[model samples]
Target chain A: MIENEFYSQQNVGPYEYYQVGEFELEEGGVIPQLQLAYRTYGTLNEQKTNAILVPTWFSGTSKNYESYIGPGRALDENEYFIIVVNQIGNGVSTSPHNSGSPIAMEAFPHIRIGDDVRAQYVLVTEKFGITELALVVGGSMGAQQTYEWAVRYPDMVKRAAPIAGTAKNTVHDFLFTQTLIDAITSDPGFKGGRYTSHTEVADGLGRHADIWAVMGLSTEFYQQELWRLFGVESVEQFTQGFLRPLFQSLDPNSLLTMAWKWQRGDVSRHTDGDLAAALNRITAKVFVMPIDEDMFFPVRDCAREQALIPNSELKVIESRLGHFGLFGAEDSYFEQVDCYLRELLASP
Target chain B: MIENEFYSQQNVGPYEYYQVGEFELEEGGVIPQLQLAYRTYGTLNEQKTNAILVPTWFSGTSKNYESYIGPGRALDENEYFIIVVNQIGNGVSTSPHNSGSPIAMEAFPHIRIGDDVRAQYVLVTEKFGITELALVVGGSMGAQQTYEWAVRYPDMVKRAAPIAGTAKNTVHDFLFTQTLIDAITSDPGFKGGRYTSHTEVADGLGRHADIWAVMGLSTEFYQQELWRLFGVESVEQFTQGFLRPLFQSLDPNSLLTMAWKWQRGDVSRHTDGDLAAALNRITAKVFVMPIDEDMFFPVRDCAREQALIPNSELKVIESRLGHFGLFGAEDSYFEQVDCYLRELLASP
Candidate 1:
């Protein structure tokens, strides 16, 4: 076991798990014993029409979405049942660090966005007896899964909002993800992913964080010295104090697994590389939201995909924080996100 | 000795040297017995008024700028004395890999853009008895030096063109440069800058190349599949065949030395960090050219500084190649660059 405290169940907060035995993947492999770690807010209505699915983003857990679910928030736990599911390989779930034996660590099977959606489908239907979802919403890689859900099971999701992500990953993003993978694997301390502790690859993790410092935030964010908003005095302090510790706490193998899947995210594979055909199957009302300054999934890239999907509108969110604006770096971020979600849910 | 053949004198072609013993750097260090490697085309006129100075960019030697100099071209070497100087730490000159002991390899002294400009000034004034330069032009780091020369020796340079570079390095660019530094240093094969051969750090060099694949070229280049022009069918081949070999051939320590200087490139240090005051010192007729899609030094950043120069015009070059367009990847790239140079050189 990697023995990383950050991923331990105790540290990840309270969450329930449903064992999914012998889960076969889209890429020709089996995760012998699979589990979907998740959390639920509020009670299911008698009609079960108010149940919403909220998938976690890259490196995020069910706990990460807790702020969005509250008594009077857009999710509104008092009115709707919100199910926040942890995407596979995100430490809190059945990830490389936690899985034992042949599947543990670097030996973990490759996971696709479709695989995560399919697994969540089983849990949503078989475990809770929920046949339909009021809405399906997520950001970044989680948004990737949201698109997979809309394309794969359109009838089940009444509305979909994919934020700061695209239906198909761009070649540019694929190359960027490769750099992230290279940053981790190049470290000798990685030991071919057999390292017993996360600290062994601290230098690599710091480098990874340094890359994010460049691309994760917008150029304007750095130009305006937005790190001051985080109460950091210098750029070094922001990188070392904020970004480094955040990444170093995670397992390198788990991060690599997510990066691989993130690079290969293409819902069009469901329709033999025909993106228009795959998206046409989606009957759910869709709002394709991309951050204005997001370098990863630029607004133009998202708007192009939005045009292919029927009944879809391009919603451009203003954020100097760029792709990382999904973290609600500014109070305005949540305000805009909540306003959009409320409108999506209220539609016929 | 690293024994990297890519940077050997034989491989870099014939070049002349000017020795300036015990050269002091702007950043509190001395490079003992400093020799500047350079090449000159055409003969100096009796009055020495037709002399043009061209400086090399990061990882570039005097040979890299040959394409821009020829008969009937903008440079018109037959009619002008063109002095192409290899910037320090560019392997051909007094660099980390070639400079033995004392202040060699990892112990090499820090170099500033001002240091390179000062050394080139000495060579032009003392070695050639050239008191005036008709024009000074360069791209990327070469552009940085062009700005430094115009600002530092405003009286000597009559015309200047800085293409695809900034006068002051942005915080965003500083962070991006850090990622490049981290990519090389993170590899265990780096051995704390004591690796005997370049191959020892092949993994790190590959990672460094991977980062370039993401940022060196514009996103439009990838989206439009422009790699096909290079005769490569896939992104992997473009990265592995073209980019990897290009960077892996250089000395890691030399690249590191250049990167550190590149990150801290600021002419404003001459005027206590007042960019406007520094740029106002330029008496030359200046043309500031920025590629349309350059991710590293965006047009807006360049435009802001161009406004600070009293007699400068912003010339936006169209290139799907982005920052690397300075390499003249497309025939049209040379056409626009030549046109601009001709116009600038013809100016009073």
Candidate 2:
């Protein structure tokens, strides 16, 4: 991987693009042909055995994930060929944030974890002649799809690592996701989602960040750090000072779509509503890493998943960073992940 | 205890002529003097030694709770005087369901658990001429007020039983209550809650019962009862068949008013946001009877209250009736409650 300079627009490599077929979105019962945008790293050996799949997180770009590459990291570019795919709702892909006149009300296809996996499957086979992956790794919503890939195409993914994700979407996750949706859609300027007004953008984004920060930590942490982070002690102050400003940079419509996709990431939709069976079908080796203190998705949820998956291990990372702990806050997390990959994911 | 004939009422009770005063709704800031409309059994005693305060549930009136009273029950009229008080939001107690005009928006006073305690205090003092209550018993929302009474006006309630009630609301409870509020406020007929049309009444109520039943039970119960109750085997069937019709019977405005009161019934509000202090303020002996299988208001919520109240006993009742089970689903609950009151309630 390139250096941190890659994230700086000055030295970034131009993104190589490959378009997969379109998918039909939700509402009005239509499976429209939706498009996919993606990028890849590393090399295929003579045996074509070094393919690792990594998907992007919620509102996260393929660039944001590039930092974990290079000579010695988890997805070391020199050791394994890593394929990072953009999810449908992110701006670089087919999303409400960057798409044309169909911004909000446009009948964007109702995509799912299944849809995402299938789209990546097309790209993997058509572009690289890869029928199987060494492993699939991702965090948050991206991790959701990774977990789904193991369930949907178990034989194709020899091993999988899903960080801070769930087997079945709980109601609390749905509530938190809904809050972000309301923040965007409730603005009078939203105009039934076909909104172009920047006025609502700030309000929508503000609510998004506030929920993320609040949900990502314990009540004790939120109480202690909210003031220091935003220079405001009260919820109102933190909401305005840090939250509103952070989200204001984002488009409201895009926020809603990303949230919509995140909440609907349950793989049970394909298994005729049997969550256990959907998980039971996962034949790929899995290392379930969940944050201990995450109020949203905790290690308890990981154990529930472990119960159904045939070949699975659980790693509980104790950290106050909550969901963020899965990213970089906890050193043991990264270490634990590396150890698991060495023993379970890195094949003979 | 006019035999079982009382329950099979042609129109419930002599509800029409029964008048105490105006309800003086706590919300909408209405200060109109209200009367207590009630029915009694047994005797008030020359010294009023047998006076038992029975607060109505969310929508229940004097008639519904009166069914639990009579000659041979735990709250036997032969042994104690029983007075069923209409809670403020119930139509019988001067609510939006029966008020001549709306309570006037933000001008409405916020009602807390403390406020309900005060309102009941006024009814007992100004109307009943009773200085002391042998015991106060209620279920669900009424139990909320009962808890307030034990603490807020300790001297007034000698013994109290708060069944299936929580001290402070949980996130799950807040979400459940918020959904009901959204259903009413979102109705186009709501028109900012200015009473635009009664057309929304049925739809709002239907959505309300749906929200209630969904949050009230575990996933296990919903699956079993779907077909027997709704004639179809899924959530959609149970909702359309049972929930919709039950909700249709409710008035939208009354639903809103009651929900607002319930959310505000935070014990923290009463004790300057000190939960433990609020619980400690109770001088009246309390029996914290929580149901084992109540999916929403679990027994753990009362754990704090138990630790706080010096004169409290936690009688854990094992039952599958969920929150409602604490209201005496079987003879076991009735016996437990009756024993607690006869032995402990009659203490100094």
Candidate 3:
């Protein structure tokens, strides 16, 4: 059986959980308690002026992005109050896989990215009473969530930083996410949502990683040292040796739920009015940073976003370090990012 | 009935029916007349001065690389003579599925990268009747042929340009290719290769495309365009669109043959001594341009190769474009390539 874990510490931050109300998804009328798992780092000032909200990327928890939360990083503990919210479907949050009888495909709710943001909004505003905030920083799917936060509640967020992300589901990300979902939902062991723990889409996940890997690195990276790094001989050893460990780390349920959120990630879709007008309405100071080699979010995407946000600038991370380059590379990326964030904070 | 046609265009160029001799696959015994299907764009001038070998890439043809041959691009037809040779199993050359009887996998001939070069050696020496090649250029699978020519027949190939490709299959490429083969061959519709054209592996092909699309483009590309590209409003529309084309493309016989050939693409396999030592024996001006954003042939892959080759220099094709960028956005790419080829041709 797949194990579901939640964390709550004295001041552990994103590990904190708040029971938001029971919300029903649009597709199936399955009602489940939408308990939000979140974390906060850097204390909120009395005026709540130093708050910066951080949403997650696809298949991510608050934990994955925790490195950027400490002092000297983007969301410095000394400067601003930071909050990292986990979207539903991640094991720490409410997901279909962990529920009782409401787990079948037909029975589970078709939760969208907007729905995820809405749920998180309740946790942020109602429970934490986060009123006027600072920045909404995220990458990949996190970028999607951050965008939603700005568009959904323009008065709340003052700045937006989306890294290695897109405002909408591009054809490439859509296909990859769709394929991954297909891999999980169609897992023979899944028994059409009945099975929870049996190798539910291990091949699919492995395939997903393979597909995802293409955008993560350069051709030079693969040809040169893949076999050597994995310490395997031949293609078979390399494929299995690494993928086996990767498969072990990812839970199938988390993959599926996060995919559902990602597939539905469109801030424009959530808005009733014109997309351009809605985009124009965003008053947040936008800093769109897409890795030069990030396949997930290309420079073209960043260019488009920068064009939309009037008070925005584009920073392309041109390193051989692919998509994950935004996180940390040869320390140069880190230093550049550190400088950029500090300048942004110290600017006005 | 997938309308299978064999085109014989002798009048297009100075052509002759060259019996490709025989191919003894290690999976089985010898098959007579292992014919090669190829085309040449430019004439091989006297003294074989202008000859530049253009080998084929994966899922490519004499037609695919023709764009690079014509004017202004790398291996420009205006300046250098281009020979686009088709590898075995590419329908026209040596193949398994096309073979009348079953060739057992064990005895299938070891058609290594060197073997492909040896076959080209026959095409160049016996058929075209030429010796010194000014340059050997290719991308992806073609790069392997170029590497083989540089190392195996160093005297013939004075310069080499291998782009967006790896020296050998990495775990990623190997798995991707293996998955492609598995999708086609393992389908129940495949019917153990006995079901002649009745059942096609549509799911497999769709799955292959799903896997391939990830490798081909950035996630942003998929996100911004997958729905329209797939021509679907809903998930079902998208699903059917991908599966149909992929399943339809699998000419069972060609797939198996190509898989076999691809598996045997290692150049050092045919060398007398250690592979690295064999590679070091090359005496050519080597230029390996491994794509920086390429997932399959990681930039490091080319770096390792450059380290191995005695006189090799590596150029990273820095672009958000994935593997296909080497072909599509050849703007940033071809200029450097053209200059290199011009310099190579300018040499003694």
Q: Number of the top candidate by DockQ?
A: 1
Clashes of each: 0, 25, 55
Residue-level lDDT of model 2, residues B1-348, one tens digit each, is 001121122534544223444444434454454444566767778897778887776655676665476676778988888877766645555455354433433223444555556766776777668889888888777778888787777777788888777667654454346656765565445666555344444554554554455445433344234234324566556556755665565556656766777766666666788988888888888888776656556677666577788888887766544654533445665776677666666577
For candidate 3, write residues B1-348 as lDDT tens digits: 232333124312232235668765444446566667677776677777778888777655666665576676656667667777877655445554445543422223445565577778888888877888888888887887888788778888888888877665554466556656655553556666554542355555566566566666544434444335434675445445554454355455555556656655665655654668867878888878877767567787678878888877777766555676655544655666666656656665
Tens-digit lDDT track of model 3 for A1-348: 254332224322338778886786645564466777888787888887888877776666787776676876767888888888887776567766555565533355667777777787787788778887777887778888878878888888888877777776665666666766765554456566555653555655665565445445544445455344435675455456664445435666667777877876776775564556667778887777787866556788668767887777887766555665644535676676666666566554
- Model 1 docking tier (incorrect/acceptable/medium/high): medium
Q: Is the docking of candidate 2 incorrect, acceptable, medium or high quality?
A: incorrect
Candidates, ranked, TM-score = 1, 3, 2
Candidate 1, residue A292: lDDT: 92
TM-score of chain A of each: 0.98, 0.85, 0.86
Angstrom error at residue A163, model 1: 0.9
Which candidate number maximizes lDDT? 1
Candidate lDDT scores, in order, read 0.89, 0.64, 0.65
Scored by TM-score, the top model is 1
